[model samples]
Target: MICVTLGRGRHRTLLEEWGQAAEAGAELVELRIDCLRSEINLKRLLTDRRTPIVFTVRRGADGGLWRGNEEKRLLLLREAIVTGVEYVDLELDIAKSIPRFGKTKRIVSYHNFRETPADLDTIAEQAREANADVVKIATMAKSVADASRILEAAARSSEKVPTVGIAMGPLGVFTRVLGRKFGAPFTFAGFNPERIFAPGMLQFDELRRDYGYERINAQTEVYAVLGDPIAHSLSPAVHNAAFQKLGINAVYVPLLIPNGKLRDSLDLLSWLDIKGMSVTIPHKEAILPMLRQADGAVDRLKACNTVVIKDKVWTGHNTDYHAAMGVLEEAYGGATSDEVSVLMDKQVLILGAGGVARTIAYGLSRRGAGVAITNRDDERAARVAAEVGCRHISWAARASTPCDILINGTPVGMHPNVDESPVPPAAFRAGMVVFDTIYHPENTMFLKLARERECRTISGVDMFVRQAALQFTLFTGKNAPDDLMRQVVARKLGVTRD
Candidate 1:
């Protein structure tokens, strides 16, 4: 079941927001009365309810806004219960003091802001001993193992009473969606993406539309993209749309795996039966040691961006190399033999020395192109150049040397910073090729300046779509719907076809 949590200061029109949640298929609406600026009028909010309502007046100690005295808070909850609400959420500390009203079940809740305690079963037993009709536990997760503990606790305690367990943060998002499969009666979500009350609350539309929450069961397959700062990824949108189009019983989510935790995170993948994953950023190189088998491309590039799991073994592959080289070859199509030979020896200058930069440089060098690397930190640039058998150029001298192709492998022109460019406009020359690896702002400042100089330009969307299509094929063993994947990504990024 999906429960939409509503807090004050997030919505100007409370009733309208509640109505919209109901229309969006919310099974329950939780009204956080403590978040209100003034006293709530129970009759006004409770009348004509389309779905069951849960009244929660949480105190400040439990990560709530209620600052009033305990007596007044209990009185307010009692009044709400009298209004015929379906449930009243009472923290475990005050559960015994508050008298339950007829037909209004009490949900005894416990929250730990620091970490998941080792004595989780003892805590659930304590809530049950306090006469709770339902038990809810939410704890902050410092690692993926913390979330695994919470899921185990919830599954073990469900026989005693209906339970809701959540690991709160980006590191625990997988638990929030997988809770229901582990015997959780319901999972909570924010009314909308912008008005979230918890750290890792899923958006209502994402649970309903992207995950197909109602249809998800134990047999459904799970997939995710692992990275740090993964909130802005569009992979979920593209992959979920493909699954829906193909009628596959699978769900894809974003997993924020911090550095040094790839091995631990992969351990949980087998425990949870995750079928596939897309690796990005720092993890592309870090995940190689954890794989049981890898493709030839991964061995050549020393990086893997896609991993497929079967019979508890992980096989890694490099889709970025294929994607980058394919786009470059297509852009130089129909050229004369002399021009083609020039491309074979094209002077390619790359920005940044990260995973993506390494992949591009290796692919180009193998094709017999002369590649140069430049970065803000000259040491890192020299390291990458040495690894790829290319020359390292100082950042200050990048513009003095001319190149046939300039590629921005950095995140300078990514979303929310669309005006920033890694290279100066003077670096762009007429008839030169300029490419950026940021797909969100389809037109970055670098691309704009390159176009004005009459240089042939390519957006990162082409590379992103091609690589994602390859990952899809690897996961499903079927021909990917390339056209549909392009359309979904373009629509999400608000890029219109010319």
Candidate 2:
């Protein structure tokens, strides 16, 4: 069950949002009465309750806006309990002062915005001692270990008292989705996606639709996409949609693993029993040496974008190489046979010397395609060129050097940077193939300008969909629904069709 937290300044707005939450299939709604600007009218606000309510009056120290004194706040809380609200949240320190009244349940909670302390188990035990029907702990997670501690504590507490342990941030998002699996009664989410009352509070719709939270259980397998800036990733949306479509007992989540921390996080990831993962950006090349086994493509490119863990063996594969080659071959109507060499001897210039660019360069070179590499940082570009045995071009000379294909491996034309193109307008020529590896916006400015110049263009969406589909097959030993995958991504990207 997802508890939708509704905190509004006005009673009317709160009531309106409560109704909206109900329409959106909310089972429990938390009314943070502390957010009201005017005098509290408990009777008027609590009247006509559509769903069971968890009445909360949070103080400033606990990440709430209750500006009154402690006495007044306690009075409000006692009043709520006396009025027989379904539940009343009480801080661990103040829970004993107010005796239980009527049928209202007690939720003894602890909030620490600074960090998840070492004595989480002891703290939870203390909350349990407060006569709590449910023990709730919310803390900031500074590392993977911190998040793991929260989950472990929750699991232990659930054996005796129902617990909701949340590490409030991107790194700890797994706990929120996996709470039920660890015996948590439910997790908290906001009614509105834009209005966030707590740090890392998920939206109600996202929990129900994107994650399919209700289906997650102890037997459900876990998969995640790992990167530093993982919030923008569409992997969870696409993969979760596929899981629901195929009736697979699995949930895919986003994890924020900072650079140089992958090796340290292995134990925590293993503890969570993560069966598979989709690697991205900085981690792609760094994860190569850590893999127990890797495909030839991954070894050759020194990068791995897909991983499958079984029997403690970690194997890696490079879906980007195969996906890029597949799309390029399709664009040129190359012979079906791999031995025919469709891109044989074609001059290809790749932008950026990152993992994606390096992978494409090596793959093209193996297919008998002549490749040249260039970047704003000449040293990195020269390094990649030497590694692939290809020529290196200066960034300023990119447009002058003639090539049959131009690939934008850089992040220049990605979403939010949509107006910026890796190559100048003069670089695009008629009949040349232009490919940009940014998928959020299907028709990037790079692809749009290439079309205007009469150049054959390929949107990053093709490669993204193809690559994700390959990952899907590897994670689940079944063929992916390719059309459904494309539709899910298109819908998430807000793409409209004719």
Best by lDDT: 2
Which digits, one per residue and each the tens of the lDDT, describe model 2 over residues 111-225?
9989999999999999999999999999999998898889889989999999999999888887899888888989999877668987788888788888999998889989999
**Which run of 10 residues does model 1 get worst, by summed lDDT?**
334-343
Q: lDDT of candidate 1?
A: 0.84
Question: What is candidate 1's CA lDDT for residue 157?
Answer: 88
lDDT of 1 at 294: 97
Q: What are the RMSDs of all candidates, in order? A: 3.4, 1.9
Tens-place lDDT digits, model 1, residues 342-391: 35889999998988888899888987899999999999999999999999
The alpha-carbon root-mean-square deviation between model 1 and the true structure, to one decimal in Å, is 3.4
lDDT of each prediction vs. the true structure? 0.84, 0.90
Stretches of model 2 off by over 4 angstroms after superposition? 495-498
